[model samples]
Target chain A: MFKSSRFPIYYKGHPRMFVKDKPIFWWALKWVHARFIIRELTSVPVAFYAIILILQIRALSLGPEAYANFTNWLKTPLSLSLHVISFLFVIYHSVTWFNLAPKAIVIRIGKNRIPGLVITGLNYVAWAIFSVAIAWLFLNLDNLM
Target chain B: MKKSSEPFWWALFGAGGVISALFIPVILFIQGLAIPLGWIESPNYQHLYQLFGSPVTRLFLLALISLSLLHWAHRFRFTLYDGLQVKHLNVLIAIFCYGGAILGSLAAGYYLWLI
Candidate 1:
């Protein structure tokens, strides 16, 4: 678990002011700021994947030729790099999302709080169902379209 | 602060659920912008896509982004304050975290419009 630092002070009979070492060094300050920015930017890939999913669905609907062209374009080196970064983002997002899941939905039955792992398990089940539904629809598009 | 921390986690949990509920279903259903489920489609998904594509969707997106940003900002603000024992530059850090979300929401809005 991420936690704050606990500094001990051993002064008796008086209240002493407590403070951490100041960030007098510029490099250290810059490093701290950069770390926060990087973590926040990691969320970008989740946004990107969402956009790509939309585009891929649209392209597929257009035609097989268009879908092939779009996917081929997506497979290019630059696109691959973006996908790689986005994949990392997706993993991070999923983990954070899952870790945060139990708190999101709490089912209470007969005076017992639902387990967090149970919540996560249900989420995975839902995602599985959703993925299958989408795949099924797309696979049968020829007949349905 | 410690006493209130318990409820903070609960709030965070509720916020996360709200975010997922709004995002996931749309993602699962959106057949690549082609299968407009609700308003854009026939009676099958009518009123649904309309709900998502309408100004209301934009509003919800804005709210989600804004609220989530604030939620994230608050989490990070304390992370810095407590984890790093940051005290001197508290205001500056607060501004960056919350301001980043404000700016981010604006960007999301622009993209939403472009799309």
Candidate 2:
């Protein structure tokens, strides 16, 4: 039989271990905590972009007049400011995601593990390629069609 | 042990993170910022409609919208659970977050199909 002291089994009336919860004040004041909070907050802007795109598609479905109205709204100062803010937040998210990629992905060949910088570098390269491809497609939509 | 559904959601979060990081920036820049700000010429409605009419474009839009929303759902769920210390309401929060994402995705699909 396993010893109770060694195994630390839970039973009736067992005392639970105590752990301190992270303080809200630390989250507000520390740079590391701020980065973590900001990273999570990026989700708001991402979700916002998704909703905007959905509305855009809906407007497109409504007809040219509706779509034009949506575009005009998009051109407004308020809309422009929101896009600018969200764009900045999204860039931060992207940068943080890429920097963390090396930690998440581990590549190895034989006895050798691929360097983390190499993994991070590849992510950046892929990001650049995708961005360029999307830009090119949009910019040349008329010519391509 | 009972199977946990955590991995399923985690996989979605990871995929969404990658997609948003790589594609969303440029999409937002062009469609949301440059075109609207008059820095880049906006594509005409006819051309945009024609583009959306393609099945490939529709599929891409569906994927982008759905996954990005899912990413938000998963991330926000954790943010609420841990950051806000609302773990006691975990089930309610999970349903609310993921349900919203699914509904938004369905709306996107419906709109895309209409176009």
Model 1 gets an lDDT of 0.53
lDDT of 1 by residue, B1-115 (tens): 3465546644743463345333534443343232432223322222333334468655765565545555556566666664455667788997896677567656666645543
Candidate 1: docking tier: incorrect
- By summed lDDT, the worst window of 10 consecutive residues in model 2 chain A runs over A1-10
- Candidate 1 Cα errors over 4 Å, as ranges: A1-82, A103-105, A130-145, B1-72, B79-86, B110-115
DockQ of each: 0.11, 0.61
Clash pairs, candidate 1, are A57-B32, A58-B32, B37-B45, B38-B45, B38-B46, B38-B49
The list of candidate 2 runs beyond 4 A from truth reads A1-16, A19-25
Error of 1 at A20 (Å): 6.5
- The residue pairs found clashing in candidate 2 are none
Docking class of 2: medium
Across A44-143, the per-residue lDDT of candidate 2 in tens digits comes to 8999999999999999999999999999999999999999999999999899999999888888999899999998899899999999999998998888
Q: Write the per-residue lDDT of candidate 2 for residues B1-115, one digit (tens) a residue.
A: 9999999998898888988898899999999999987888987788889998899989988999999999999999998765766677889999999999999999999999999
> Which candidate comes out best when scored by DockQ?
2
